[model samples]
Target: MNAGAVGSDDPGPLVLGPMLRYIGETDATVWVETSRPGVVTVHVDGREWAAPTFAVKGHHYALVVVDALEPGGAWDYAVHIDGALVWPEPDSAFPPPRIATMDRERPTRLLFGSCRTTVPHDREGHRTNGVDALRTLALALARGEEEWPDLVAFLGDQVYADDTSQAMREFIAARRDIDKPPGEEIKDYEEYAHLYQLAWGDEANRWLLSTVPSCMIFDDHDIRDDWNTSWTWHEEINRTSWWHERLMGGLSSYWVYQHIGNLSPSQLADDEIYARVLEAASGASGADRVEGSELDLTEAVFDLARRTDRHPEVYRWSYRRDLGDSRLVVVDSRAARVLEPQHRSMLDPDEMRWLDEQLSGDVEHLLIGTSLPFLLPPGLHDLEAIDEALAMGKHGRIAAQGAEKARQSIDLEHWAAFNDGFVEVFEMVMQVARGERGRAPSSVVFLSGDVHNSYVAEVVDAKARHGASSRIVQAVCSPIRNPMPRMVRVMMSSFARGLVRPMRFVAEHSKHVPEPAYPWAVTDGPWFDNCLAELTVQGRDLSIVWRGGEIRDGDDAHPVLTTVASVRLPGPSGQPPGALGWASGSSAGSVS
Candidate 1:
C-alpha cells in the first residue's frame, strides 16, 4: 500500500482513499479507509462535512457526504482524520484532489474500460501485460495533458478474486493454508479488502480515483469465472463447501466498497443498510474513543449480503445517473440474473422492469452501461444463441447436457445466450430509438466491456423499411490491463472477420433459434489491447476514442498513451444512416 504518513513525526491515519465517489448538483460523497475508527472530515471552501467511521470486521471506513455546494462547482478539498490532515501527503507530485460538480450546460465526457488486474507498475509487469492504460491516463490527467472526464466508469472486473497475483497469493498464504479449498482465491471479506487495496493502492491511480468520480459494475472475475452463468452452473457451485462464504464475502464487500457510493444522496438516504450504518455510528463518541467503540457492521453487512444472494429483488445494484441532457443506466448484469434452466434471463423480472422504465428518451443521448455487451459481434451472437438453444434441450436432452459443459467451458453467457431477455431488451431499446417512448435521442449508445477486445458496432434496420431516427450503436472498450492470449485472439479474429455469413446462415436455418430483431455490423474494431475509451457527448454530436499505453525509450515508469481507434457518428441533421468518419491511421488490430 502507498504510504499515508505526511512527515517524520506524524504517521497518518488514512489507509486507502479520499476517493471522490458520487457527485451531484450540490452534494458529493468522498469515501475513505482509515487506519482506526475516527470521524473523517472533508474541508472545502471554508465548509466542512464529517462522517463517523463504521467498522466492518476491524476495518474502519467512512463516506463523508459534502453538501450545499454550487452546481458546476470545482473546489479543492482536504481530508482530515480526527482533526488531523491526512490527505494530499507532503511533497506530493500530483495536484490536490478536487471535487468537481456536474455542469449540465457542458458536454459529458465519460472514460471507461474493464478487466484491470493489480500488478507492479514496473518493466516486468509491463512486459507481461503491457503498460497499465489507466495509470498512463492518470499521469496524463495529472499533468493536465488531457481534460478530466465527467465520470470514469469501471464496467466490470475491478478486482479478480479468482485470478490472484503473486502478491495476493502471498497475502493469502500468510493468512491460511493454500492447500485448502478456495486456495489462492479470495475466501472472505477480509481477503477481498486486501485485494481491493492492491488494485487501487498504486499512487498514481489512487490520486486519479481521488479526483475523478467513478461508477462500477461487477463481471465474472469479481467473484469467479462464469459466476451465475446458469442454473446448472449455480447448482454445481453450490455443492462446494466454500462457495457460500465466498459469495457472502464478495457480495458484502461489493455493497460496502462499490455499490453504496453509486447511489445519489437521496438514494443513499433511502437505503436501509446505509441508514442502519449511520444510525449505529451516530451514537459513537468523538474520535477520542472511536478507536474501540465505533459501530461494528460485520453481522449487518453479512446478513444483507445473504439476503441479497437469496432474493436479489430486495436490493438493487442497478442504478441510473442523469447528467445534464444525457442519462446513464448502469445494469447489474451479473448478480441480478434469473438463472433457471427453463427460463434463463440476463436480468430478473424486477430488474427488467426497472430497465424498461429507465430506457425512455427525451435527452440528447441515452447510454446503457452493462458489464457484458448487450450486442456482440454478429457471428459470436449467433453462436451464443445457438448454444443457448442446445443447452435448453431444443436439440434433445443428450445434446443439452453436452451444450451445458461447452457453455461453462467457453464462457458463452452474454446477452445472446439469454435469447428471451435479449429480444425483450432489444425491443425496449428499439422503442426508445424509434421515439415511441419519447423524443428520439440523437443516439442510443450501449457502453460495455468484456470479451478482452474493443470494438464499435452500429445497429441497422434489418429490413430496409421504417428506419429509426436515432443512431443505434454499441461501443465496447475492454481489458484496461489484461491482454488476450495470441491463440484466443486468432480465434476471436476469425469469429469477427470470417464467420459472419456462415453463422447467420446457421441461425436462420435453426428451428429453435429466433432471428434477431435488428442486424448490426462492426464499424471500427476488433482491436485487442489493454486500452481505455473516452466518449464525449455534446448536443447531438457523439464521438468515441480508444487509446492504449505505449512505452518509449524503455521508460516504463511514464508510459505514453497512443490512440488505437477513433470514430465520429454524425448527428441527426439528415446525415445518412451508417455514415461514419473514421479517423485516419486508426487501424484495427492488436496494439501489443
Candidate 2:
C-alpha cells in the first residue's frame, strides 16, 4: 500500500469496511456501501481499477476488483466515491489520529481484530470511546506515516444492529415510526436499512474500509446473540411472531450491510441471487446496480439464507484466500450450523466437507478465522459441552425442561455448546495436524475473537489423541475497542485452568466417554484491550504481534507493539517468558 492517499476536505459517507475479503480464485473484490447512487473509484497503487456498483433491496454497494495482482506483493489503494476522498485527512477529528498500513515486500503483515460495537460515535467525545484503534492505524496509512499491510482479516461482529448506540438510536428515531417503545429495535427491511446507516456512518472508519483489503464474517451480535444455535434457541426466538421479523431483519441486513462484499466469484455463484448482481456488473451500463441493487435479488438471497438451514450448500458464509504461501479460511460460525437439536453439529456436514477441501498441504501457515474460538478456556469449553449434553435429555428434569430455559439465559452454543460441531472441527484439524489428507500446513492456527479477552494456546497430545504431537495454535484478538468489565478478569483467572481439570473428571466419570487428555497450554496471556493483531512472516519464522493505541504522559500519542509472539515451524522447546519478549500495549514515546 503506497499510503500516499490524497485527503479531501469533503470526506464522503460511503463507509468501507470492517474491510475484509480475500484474493482467491475470484478477482480481489473490494466491498463498500454508499448512502445513495454514486460512482466510487478504487485506486490500486495509484491506478484506477474495476468499479462495479449495484443496489440491493434498497442499500447501495460497490465492488472494485484490482485484476491479476501478484500473490506475494503489497498493494495500497485509495478510494474516491463520486469525486470525494473517502478517508479523513491527517489529524483525524477523533484525536491523536491513526498510524495505519506498513509497507512490506512479501505477505508478512496481517492486521486483524473483531467484535467492535457500532455505538453512536460520541460526538461530544465523552462516553464516545473517542478514536478507533484500527482507524488510528488508518490515519497513519493515509498520511504515509506507516507501512501498508498485506491483508486485514476481520473475525466477526462487524455490525451490531441488535446492540445499537445512542447515535444509532437517534438515527432510528427520525427515520422510523415504530410504536414498540424507545428501545424497540429495528424489525424488518426498512428499519434494517436505517440500522446499517448507523453502523457505517463514521467517515474515518469508512475511509479505512475503502482502502484496506479486508475479509469478514459474522458473529452473534451482527444479528442477535446465540442466533441459529439449537431447536431450543430457535423455539424461544420463534415463540414471538416478531422474533422471525427481528431475525430476518438482522440476517437480511447482514447480507446487505456486510456479506455481499465478502463473496468470491465462486461463493457468489452459490449465493443464487447475488450471482445475478455479479453478472449484471459486467453489463454495458447497468453495472451501477451493484450500488443500488439492494432490496432486490440481494434481499431475496438473505431471506432464503436466513429462513432455511435446509439448503446448507446453496449459500455459504465461509471463504478462503491465498497470500503467497499462507492460506486463510474464514468460517461463518453463525450460519453454517446444524442447530436444530442440541446433539446437532455447529457446522453442517456439507460445509465441513467443503472446508476439508479448502485446507490443503501447501501453505506455510493456515489460519482458520472463526468468531468463536475453537478452543475456549478448557473450563468454558467443558461447561458449554456439559450444558449441551444436559440439554440433550441426559439428566431427567434439567434435560427435559430446565435445560431449555437455562439455554435461553446463558450462551451455551459456541463450538463447545454444540459439541458435535466442536468435535467435528477438532477432529478435522487433528486430521490435518496428523498429516492425513490436506497439505498438513506447518501451523494449523485458529484465529478467533469473542471471548471478550485474548490469549494464545497450542494444542498438543491429549489423552484422547494419545501420542499426537501436532502444533495447533489458537490465537485470539478481541474488541478492537470494547474491553470487558474488570471484575470478571479476576474470576476468569481463578476458574480458568482449574475449570478444565474438573471438566475432564466429569466427562470421564459421568459421561463415560473417554476424554482427550488436556494437553494445550496458554503461552502468551489473557490480555484485554482494544487491540489489532499484526501477523508477519519475516523469513522462516512467523510472528503475530498485538498492537494497542495509546495517549502519552503529555497526552500526545502513537501506536506501538503491545504483545509480540513468534512461531517458527517446530518452534523452540525450552523457552522462558521473556524469550518471546513482551512490552506494554504502548512501547515508549508517543509519535506526536
Candidate 3:
C-alpha cells in the first residue's frame, strides 16, 4: 500500500488503480496526482528527484520530469509519496520496475488504455478489490514479476465528474447542492474537486501514478460526455448555468489534474502559466501558497487551456517525444477540435498541422495518442454514420438524436459519430501508413482506449498483411476497470463487427479512410473485463500481447481473476511464452 494515501490500519492493502501509464522519451517526465500534499519522487534506475506537486480543487498532483536520460536503455523506479514508500502489486498488468527506453538504441513497448469510472468493487464498496488491471501490473514490478514497459499511454476519460459513482455522490452531497438534476451530470467546482479526489485518491492507483512516467490525452468524460463535438452540441450544453460552471470546473481542474505534467522544460519556458507553475513549484509555497486555494489557480489555468488555441504557440496541448528510435505524438483531441460548423475538424488548423507533421515514419515505430480511436469497429462506425447522416434532415434529426441517445445508453461515442473529424484523423494516419507525405516508419500504430472492452486488431492492407500497402491494425485496452453493464458486452461486439466499415466509407468526409480500398483490418481477439495490451517493437518487428486477470477453479468459493490472454504478435523477435502465459522478450532491439 502507498503510505500517504491510506490512513492508519492501512485500509486493507492500498492497491493501485486504473490508468497505470508509462511514457518515456529521451527525457522521461512522469506525471501523476496524490491523495494529499507531500513530496512524490521517482527513483529512476538509481537517481531520484523530489518531484514537485500542486494542490488544486482538493486534489494533489505532479508531473515528475526526469531529464538527461539515454534512449534505448532500461531503468527501474520506486515511488515515494510523502514519507511512505509504495510499489505496484505482484499481479499488476502493467510491467513494472525496469523499462527499456526507445530511440535508435532499443525496442519500444507501449501499453495504453482509458475510460475508467471510479466505482467501488462490487463487494468492497471501496476503490480496491476485484481484478484491478493497473494494480496487477504495478504489483508485478513491486515484486519483480514482470517486464517493465517502455511507455504507457492513457487515452481519455481519466476523471468522470459527470458519471460519478455512489461514493462520489455522497462526497458531492457533503459539499454542495445535488438537489437539481443538472440532471445526470456534475455541476460546479466543488463537485468537480471532490470527484477528482475519489477518482485518483485511491491508495493502490496513487502508487502506480507516482512511479510510471505517463502520457495522457483527454476525452469527453474528462469534462462531460459529447464535449465540444459541434456547435449545436455546445449550444445545447450551454443552455444551463450549471453547464458553464461544470465546464469551467472540469476544464479548470484538468489544467491542474492532467495537463500540468505534460509540459517539457522548453515548453514550460514558453508557456506563461506553466512557467509560473514551475517558478512557484521551485519556491516554498508553490501554487498552494500563490492563491487562497489551489482551486483559484486551477480555475484560471483551465480558462487558459480553453483559450490557448485561439492564441496559438502559447497554449498548445499537443506534445512530441523522441524515445530512442520511436516517436510518440500525444495529441489533445478534446481541446484542439474545430467543432464550429463553418470548419469542423478533429483538430484545429494549427493543431492539425502539428499532428500532421508528426505523422511521418521517421522513427522505428510511430505511436499516435488520440483519446478517441482514429478508426472504430466497422459496425459501430457505420451505425454512427447512419445516425449522423440522419441528423442532417428533418425526420433524420429526430431519428439521429434518438439513436445517439441509444448509443449513449450503451456508451458508444468514438470516431464514427463525428464522421468529418474522424475521416481527417484517418487520412492523417493512412498518409503515414502509406508514407506518402514523408518517410513511413517501420510500424504505424494507434494506441487508444475509451470503449469498455480490450482487444488487439492489426490493420492489414487489402492485398498484403505486411507490405508497402498494408492495412493498419488497432489495439485497444479499455475500462482498466470494468465499467460496462454485463448485458451490453455481446451487443457492443456485435455492433462493432457488423457496422464499422460501411459507416467509415460513407463518412469519409476528410479523405483518410479509403473507400472500398480502406487500408486496415483487425487481426487480434477482443477481451473485456479489466484488461491491458502490451506491444513490443524490436527493430522492424512488433509483438502485441493482450493481458487480463483470471479466476482460479478452486482455492476459495469465489475464484480470483488472473492473467487470461497473452495473444503474441507474430514476430521472430516476440517473446517465448512459458506454459501459463508469461512471455520472455526476444531480441526485438537493435541494441546489444
Candidate 4:
C-alpha cells in the first residue's frame, strides 16, 4: 500500500467501485477505492471530472462529483486513475457503465431489499443461504432484459459485522488470533474495509452499483445483532475490552463507505468532515504539511465516530429525497434510538421531530424507508409491546430481568418494542393520511426490510373514522441472500397467524399495555424467500413486486428471477381499474 506515490507513472489499481451514487437531474457522485493515492477521474459525455484521492489509514479513496449533465440523459461512462483507463476491464462481457439521470416525466422505480451475506456464488453457498436476488437483478440489468431502476435503497444489514463468513474468518485468522477477544467478528476499521470489499467486489454486483444510484442505511447486523436494543444491552456491550474499537471502526468505516454516498451534493458540502477532507486534500488549508498532499482522514473520522456514538443527537443519519411528485424519506432507526430505560424510544426527540417534518404528503406517493417495519404482524406486535412493558418494570424487577433476556434472545426490539415511540409515529402517519400535514398523498407507504421475511400490511379503519385520504400500507422485503432456518420460519408463521387472536385479547386487557390507535392486518404473504422488492410509482398508480432468484437447469452461475408476490395498492378513491390478478382487496380483517 504505497501512501504518496506521485503521478501517472505509478498509477495505482482501481480496487472497488465507480459506484454511482447520489444522482440528480444534472449531477452525480462516483466513489472509488484505489491501491494508492492518485486522482480519480470520470469520463462521460465527452467530458471528464477529476478529484484528488484522500487517505484513511493506509487506504486511498476518492469521490468524483460529475456535474453539468443534460436532464433525463443517459451517458455511458469510464473511469481513469491518474489518466489511465482502469474500468471496463479488457474483455468485459457486460455493457459499459452508464449514468441515467432522473426524469420527472417517467415513472420512478426503486429496487430495494436488505440482509445480504457475502459467499461464493456456487451450489454450496446457494444451498446454505440462497441464490442472491440482487445478483440475479444485476445479471438481468446487464443483459438488458429488465428495466433499470432510478435508485436502489438498501434498507439495512448490508454486511454482518458479527457473523463472519468462512472467507472473512480466514482473512481474520491470517491477521490476528481469531480465538481471542472479538473472535471472528470485525474489530477495527481495516477489517471493515476488507469486509465491504468482499461484500461489493463481486463483478456482477459491482457492475450494477456502477450503473445505478444507491442509498443505504445500516441495521443491527451492520455492527452486531441486537445492537442498541436497550440501555442494559448497551452497558453490557460497553463493558467488553474490544467494544470501543469495534464501535469506532464500524461507525467510521460506515461514514466513509456508505453514509457519505447516500447524501446529495449539497448535503455533502454541508458535512463538516467532508468539508475538512476536501479542504486539506486541495491544499487550501494553511496547516503544516508533509508536502501538503492528499489529506489523511483516519483520525478525523474516528473523532466524528466517537462523538456520534456518545451523543447520537449531534448527527442525523436520516435524509429525504423528492423524486418528481413522490417523496422518499429514509429513516435511521437503529442509531437514533433513545435508550433511556424510563422513556425508551426507537427515535430520540430530535429525530422524531425531523421525521414529523419529512412526512408531509403533497406528493402523490410518500415512501418511508425504515430498516425495521413500522407495522409488524398484529400478534407479534402485541407480544413485543407486552415484552417492552415488562422490561420497563411494569411487573417489577424479577419480571423485568426475565423480559430483558427474552427481548435479546428473540430479537424483539423493533418499533413495537418501543411502544410509546411506535404510537407517536403512528399518530404522525395518521395525521399525514388524514390530510393534516398537507394535501394528503394518494398513498402513505412504509417500505422496510428486516425480520427475515417479506409481507404487506394495510391499515384498517373499519368505520372510516379518520376520514383518511391516503391509502396507508407497509411493504417489507428482506434477505437479498440469507434465508431463515426452517424452525425460525415456522415460529414466525405461527406469530403471523396462530397467535393473533390470543395476543390481541391479552394486549387489550393488560393494564400495562396501551391500545393501538389503529388496527392493521397483513394483506399479502409472509413469504420467506430471499428476495428483492420493486416499488413503481407512476402518477397516482402504485404497485409493488417481490422477486427472488431461482436456479434453472442447475446453472449456479446464473439464477433466473421469479416473482414471489405482486400487489397493486389502492389509491384514495379505490382500487385502480384493471388491477393485476394477484392484487388483493384492502378490506378490514382480523390480524393475518
- Every candidate's CA RMSD: 2.8, 5.7, 7.2, 4.2
Taking the tens digit of each residue's C-alpha lDDT, what string does model 3 give over 1-592?
A: 3433422334322222222333444555555555555566767777886655565565556656566777656676666766466555444444455434445555666677787667653445322423556655665555566776666667888778677777777666666667775654677666666666576665445555655556777788888877766556667777866776677677666665566556665775676666655666566354336443232255556667456534533567778766676777888777766655334566667777777787776566777777776666655656555554554432446765775565555544456656566677767766776667666665566778877766655554322433343235566777776545545667666666766655665657523323423544554445556755677875766666655443344222222324435544432223221111134322111011
- lDDT agreement with native, every candidate: 0.86, 0.62, 0.59, 0.85
Using all chains and alpha carbons, the TM-scores for the candidates as numbered come to 0.96, 0.82, 0.77, 0.95
Location of the lowest summed lDDT over 10 successive residues in candidate 1 = 1-10
lDDT string for model 1 (173-290, tens) is 9889999999999999999988888898888998999999999999999999999999999999999989999999998899878988898888887998787666655673443333
Segments in model 1 whose C-alpha atoms lie over 4 Å from true places: 1-11, 281-293, 462-466, 584-592
lDDT of 2 by residue, 371-403 (tens): 988877776677777777777777876465766
Error of 2 at 494 (Å): 2.1
lDDT of 4: 0.85
Better of 1 and 2 by TM-score: 1
TM-score of 4: 0.95
TM-score leader: 1
Model 4 per-residue lDDT tens digits across residues 378-495? 9899989999999999999999999999999998999999988899998998888888888988888899998889888887762275678787888899979888886778777876
Worst 10 residues of 2 by lDDT: 1-10
- Misplaced by over 4 Å in model 4 are 1-12, 286-292, 576-592
The per-residue C-alpha lDDT of model 2 at residue 478 equals 83
